[model samples]
Target chain A: MPAERRARPADAAKVQRWLDVVAALLRRSPDRLTFVELAEQVPAYGRGLRSRGDERWQESAVARMWERDKDELRALGVPIGVYPDAGGNRSRYGLETHEFYLPFVHSLDGTPARRTGGPPGVSMVAFSPEELAMIRRAAGRAAQLGDPAVADAARRAMASVAHDLAAFDPDADHGETVVGQPLDPTVLRTVGDALVKGRRIRCRYRSMHRDVTASRTLEPLGLVFQLGHWYVVARDPGDERLKTFRASRMSAVESLAPNGAVAPPRGFALAAHAASREAWELGDGEAVTVRLSVAVHIALGDLPGAAPASAAVGPRARTRAATMQVRRLEPFLRWLLAFGGEVRPTAPRHVVQAFRDLAARTAATYGAGS
Target chain B: MSAVARFARLLRLLPKVADGTPRRIGDVAKALRVPAALVREDLQSLAERVEDTSGGFIEGVQVLLDRDHVTVRSRWFRRPLGLSADERAAVALGLAMLAQEGPAESVPAIQRAREKLGRLGPGDAAVRAGRIGPAAPRTAVAGAQRETRYLAALQQAWVARREVELAYRKPGARAAEPRVVRPWRLVSARGAWFLIAEDAARRAARVFRLDRIDGVRLRSATYEVPAGFAVEDVLRDGRVFMGAGAGTLEVRYGPAIARWIAEREPHERQPDGSIVVQYPLADDAWAVRHVLRYGPDAEVLAPARIRELVLAVLRRMV
Candidate 1:
């Protein structure tokens, strides 16, 4: 399968549960399924199975209901194939691609930067009139350059600041303690240059976890603002590896000239390497092939080459009769690992063995191994 | 294929009068890289496309040639094809947006350019309509709210000139931390709001995330906003938190990897278009990991340090 599959996740529990039922249906029915029939069999979290006679359902409702059904199927690692029927009959819907594809949707599992709460030891400070004017101008300029409606909204909010400046009494005991002071201008400018020029920057960094100090050269690439603090997307030249560093963690910065090399692309774009984690990165390196037997729990019966979408799989049916070829192994492994033993890693013995060994090792460590 | 194509061919060739100018049929043909016979056959057809109206349109279409050179001189008039209404609205909106970003002084130049386009009516009506500026909607009410926030912080900072306490959260970090910092100038980097301040405890400049700031309060102390505090310096300080880290990496290439790299331009291109290129990286692990993704197609070449790291990682995985 394409590595792009890893980009979409059963990122949320709602979707993850949906995938489980879909996978079960695919395992049982490998052929094409009518939308209604598939949705009937797919389980719902809080509701008991509905009778096929339930007249409350509409085609649009069926369509909407399948989103969760499909999401859950993907989470369980079942591929649901869809195709246009060649017979031209109105009732026939064929399965097209052999493998299942989950549409590209933004996962709800936001990164750590998105979590709420201010930086430690700090209290909220409202913007002043002059500062609001600057913010409005700044946000407007930013929107004009690239960002869309959100930037415009920011500008609108900035412009709303009332001019009557009220003095904030520091000792008035607002019942909140300030965490850190405003950053000096000199440092922000220096860091901005390093990022723009993609040059090596030398800086005095203080580790947050421990009392340690060190000077290091960083190849700056990108910057991200999340959860109310500045963070640099830099690679440590010493290690030549990428890592996110907090702005507050640094003690000082020493600027350096560009090394004449063009900087790598970064920012918020999906294509940017920063957006993907290391596991996804691994699958991109080399493509590996794996073979798997469809479990009875999957609804592969609806697949064109397979059986019907509603084929029943009784527990005693027993034989491991189906198999498939998968190209990328890392993401598959990660996804399969999350399934525990429900979906077995069948082949490329190395991969299967690796999974087995890992499980064994963990079990032994926990004194639960046979 | 047609008289039109032949005429276009001749007009395009007029620029290459490389040596001394030649005005004869042969010179024009030679300049155009075409046979003289072909040039002669197309001259009439080409003349028709070069309009000089009032009947003078066709008259000016005639080309004058002398032993020294060939010159195209004419008082030609052609009907204008204007822009549609939607296009005009789009242009007006775009211009208004552009005006917002640039210095106020540039607005006049924009107006003048619009006037010139209008006078040159040879273009579409939409193009002409674009000359008139689109009025921007008012946002004074919301602007007041934003001002209240900015001023409140500014006044607090001004009073303390000493470090104002800030709460900041760096993205991707497991959690946010507390830091004491002296407030400096607040600016926007790209689109995000940022506060440039000095770390009072560390005695170094740093940037704070305005949104992540849960709290802010001024202390009873005073310190200058530091005359030498350059915005760029603080940005660099903030950058360290951005890049993964810098390290050297060695990539080895097999024939397939070499060909793939060559075709895709995956790495930076050298003037020679060689298969391999190297540089200092902020995120060495990321680079090495990325290179490894190419699988058997590429290899990691020395400095042996990176190779050892990759090997060590793979060994642990295996």
Candidate 2:
């Protein structure tokens, strides 16, 4: 509603000032302009310079305003370069056209019209129709994820791309992709901001396996969405070990001050942390490799992290032996049970026995009909 | 509005109006999803000129604004800004989620888009490699590929407005039943895919889990999605099983797992630290599997019929 309100006249003047500054910088690009020269050229900053009272104070105030404006422009993806002035202590700024503007997009079949250094003063990027369609669908899917911050970003990205390609429409109907699991949008926004800023966060986390709630301070490394849950991979300051906390289980998430911020270690790869692991491997139980006799019809490639144990015992074997590591027995048993009789544990007598016990108990429970 | 936000919006706006063609202010606002008053304000701002210290004027964008129409005569900012880091991450993660869950046919397109976006620069490359933004799991569970295959076929039928003969197996059923249905839409919730269609025999909408669907045969007979038919009418609040004459069932969770269950949905905590939740039960078989998944951690507290069904299912499993 606030955004819908009519902007005051002063707002328009401020926007005009900002636009004038950018246009001036672009026109005089390749030749940096000092703060003094820019202040003289832009009317808003020039007003302070023209004041007869307290020249030093006025200049400092103007400098602070410039700093804020420069930061805001940079946040908008405008690449403004700052360089030390050769003649004085003042700083000179410039905005390169290529860095400030999007590249000219060309279809794959089109030839390179001009080089980067040509008079057009813009570089070209090529995209096939297939690539654009995928990008469109990706943006559409993200818009349906039910997170406001993520949906906003997705919409803006699609709008920008659609502007260049006449054939692409951002508002086209793409089938929905929804996450059934509920997510706390506020928690996700806080964690995302902290991760991007390289800051620490403190939150009350409820550990599902241990069923305990405690406050923790962690340096967020990355965010991963797996198995219908969003997990924040962070390093606990106390243990100095990485841990993953489900976002839905987090409450009162707050970003720490800049003083508590810490950068991730060098050579840390988030993809490694985000790699998919089986449900059984996510627990804290001791790891053990269990061999299973999988039906021949079931494809081995469908199972991640599973390897063939040995050759089949003759060609007539209806099942093949395969082995996979397990960290927790319960989840593994539950997963295997979902396949009914198609999969069976064949090794580690205790695991096989445990599986039979669970199956038996489940059956007994059902047999005791109300 | 903040000066930066307004400036960014003006940049988006300039590309649309700068072609020197007259456009309705309401039309522009609708396209941009902004208020018409805000668009008018931005147009006025773009047409304003600022005075320099030299007593001269620096012209803003040239524009012609009227009560209902506006046109601009400047070539400045004709192209929209490149995708920002956050935007790139959002898009990359989205593509990753789709690749992990969408139809197999989309994999090649998703991969090609990622490669092209990565070629843009180091920032884009980092996003593509999952160094920035949320990353989706690279691998999926077994039989997910088959589900996606079915998803592709169902999507085609839905788009073509054709009926499909589906071999769908109910929970605990020994064989899949063949049924002809008019495909409406394919929805992916949690990690599973589902097709919301109208069963021809019953002439009623039904939600069929894609994993339970053994085969799909497209039919030459076509049908229209009923007027005002909405996916929400079937999947209320992202839930799959919403049947007519559904009854409320209560289930209790032990204290150890109560907090986890509470995190998932609303529930009432009992004095003993256990929590009780009322769920809408549309199918008795679905309720049986749902309770069994929790093992002893959960128990049926009400609806004796469901309790009996759970016991019967467990006995059958044994």
Candidate 3:
């Protein structure tokens, strides 16, 4: 077995400094401390100042270090507040006591005596046992999503919950099991991180219809896991149009920024884009409404964006008539063809002709001419 | 892990062990979902003293680490940290997915949990951005709802160790058949649910697709799962279908859909730009439907019986 890579001494000391800084801030909560005061509280910030030849560089480095520490803590949901002084140079930072800590979670059935003023820096939230169990099951299910980004986030969320609960046994079984879909963990993680951080990504995407791989830059807005696949709903900066790219088809996904340098367009609703769309409606072609004779048992509403059409009599009397808008004809044809004789496209002359041609071509492939 | 990540973990870890109670390192590691050695390293770092501005050492937290167990005495960070934005979003998405795919009865509880987590409320940016919540709209797909209903009932039966008689309609069958089985486990694979159970009549384990089950009637008789039986034992090949005599199926995809097919599962690329895959074939009717779904994009390459079945379906369709 390969040896474990231990943490360097310098890294350990840096972590210790961070711990000390957080301790100082929490100890003096609700009281703002300037950078000078914080430096006093965390001695490591001023250490080796005299030994360095570049005093000015060392001072700026210390300032940058302080800024980094604050950003890191805020990222961990520490709720560190900053108040700039009148001079606009000296900023006082402090921890928001109420927001820093998790609320006291209790079972709804328990009716403990309420203190007129509970302990300082503490609040409460109540949930039933079944509710808590559901949350636990949800976390477990999320961990099995086959997406590393989601799994890590789920683990962190559950850890926080476990910390607040007394006598929390992590080994307790939740009676839920999942066989997650096989997905590219790297692509999922990269795309997910970019979406969460609101960053742009450059990737090589293999387009299925065109059967060509092309490099493109995208501003990732949201992630959707549907139909046993993960998709990134993003916008091409060049066109400023929303497109959904299957996560598995993306390769070499590289984030363009260190932080969230870009934000989604104003008033853009991701739900509208993330809604379960049929294969045919996902294309960029001109809209074509194709009338179909669908089996009565198949609900039109369930077909996603389908509307009832005027029924025809005679041979098609038993089947209901429906019309659905199609952006890509091939996928629409394939979808209708999949239902075999149960569904038939009877619409504008071209659509019916195209359907026949496809069927004939398919039959020809099996040595049966149309 | 990077030092910053380690720092964040240490912040969370301090609250876990700072209650002045002795906790086994292994137990703490398991609870934190981290390696035991990493836990030990964090504890060691916490035990070290830091120099204050006045040339004096300040002991933030006192740690008592021994061979197997460790305890900490600290007045700092005794409370757990609140969930970060990303973490909250993740939890919200989990609840949302469960709301969509879990048992129907759990919806209310799932909703309550979401409300408590400050999600799903009006004007929530995360919800607006579609970062967290159900990916699909809540339009009830009859087939999906039916599967969830059967899944809920089967789950209860499995937990109670009760035998269930399923009105299961096999593929291509016109009528449902009654099958008595002892429920063992409910597993989801490839976006579908299946029941890994023991067939009482055959006295052997079988896998049943939840959608194909017309109805589930709980039987009064209870049965114990065999000691040596494991879900993996039946699903060793990673294929959910467990027909009596399964064979390997070879199919080739046309160039047009080859890239799409390659994205889904493993396949070998042919020089002609097509792709060939060996799939597990258990039911002839399933193979026919699978090929029919792809239309002419897919062709049965080997296994003449399966090829014949595909041709037969194509002939009927044409």
Each model's lDDT comes to 0.40, 0.71, 0.70
Taking the tens digit of each residue's C-alpha lDDT, what string does model 1 give over A1-370? 2343221222222332332333333334445655545444443421222433344444344455555444433222233444445675443222211222111111122311211111121112233333223333333333332213223333322221111112311112111111222344455446655653456778887654454678877776654432223456677665545676666566578678767643544443311433323243353345454544454543342111232322455667532433434445544454444323434556678988866554443333223333
| Local accuracy of candidate 1 as per-residue lDDT tens digits, B116-150 | 32222112321233221121111110001111133
> Cα RMSD (Å) per model?
30.7, 5.1, 5.6
Clashing residue pairs found in predicted model 3? none
Give the clash count for each candidate: 157, 1, 0
Which stretches of candidate 1 lie above 4 Å from their native place?
A: A1-370, B1-302
User: Model 2: which residue pairs collide?
Assistant: A366-B311
| Reference-based TM-score, model 3 | 0.82
DockQ of the candidate models in sequence: 0.01, 0.31, 0.34
TM-score of 2: 0.83
- Sort the candidates on TM-score, descending order: 2, 3, 1
Give the C-alpha miss distance for residue A241 in model 3, angstroms.
Answer: 1.3
User: Residue by residue across A1-370, what tens digits does model 3's lDDT show?
Assistant: 1134466666777777877777777777778887666666677775634234333533667778877777765555556667667788547877655566766666565555231211376667677877776677667766766777677777877776665466444345444456655666888777766665667899999887787899989888777776556777788875677787877788998988754455667877665557666678875688998888876645464465788886444453568888889999887787777666567788888998888777777767777768
TM-score of every model? 0.25, 0.83, 0.82
lDDT of 3 at A286: 88
Winner by DockQ: 3
Report the Cα lDDT for candidate 3. Answer: 0.70
